[model samples]
Target: MTSIKIDRSACQGYGNCVLALASVFDVDGEGLVVLRRDTVEPGELDGLRRAAYDCPTDSITFVA
Candidate 1:
């Protein structure tokens, strides 16, 4: 399974990840991006990667 990790300290609440992969990520009421699903579904790998890469602070990490 692919695992997703986010560094809250480095996150700027840009919501890029949420917009890129709503299934695995979302912006909470505070506007901070949250990982709704830590493990990526098989078909969602691409979107997850895109979200991680799109993060301006590079706060997202993927582990296989």
Candidate 2:
């Protein structure tokens, strides 16, 4: 199992994370990143990595 973390302060509202995985990431009204879901299942690892990799600000990280 895995979990995700978001550093809102580091988020630039690029929405790349959302684009990579909308089921786990969202954009708030303030244009900050929000978590739709934090837990990452084994099958979701690829999408998780994509979201983390796509984040230019590196606001999202995963813990296993």
The Cα local distance difference test for each model comes to: 0.88, 0.92
Q: Residue by residue across 2-56, what tens digits does model 1's lDDT show?
A: 9989888888899999889998888877788888878987788999889988999
The segments of candidate 1 whose C-alpha lies over 4 angstroms from its true place after superposition are none
Q: RMSD for each model, in Å, please?
A: 0.9, 0.7
lDDT assessment of candidate 2: 0.92
TM-score, structure 2 vs. true: 0.94
Candidates' TM-scores?
Answer: 0.91, 0.94
Worst 10 residues of 1 by lDDT: 26-35
- Clashes (backbone N, CA, C under 3 Å), per candidate, total 0, 0
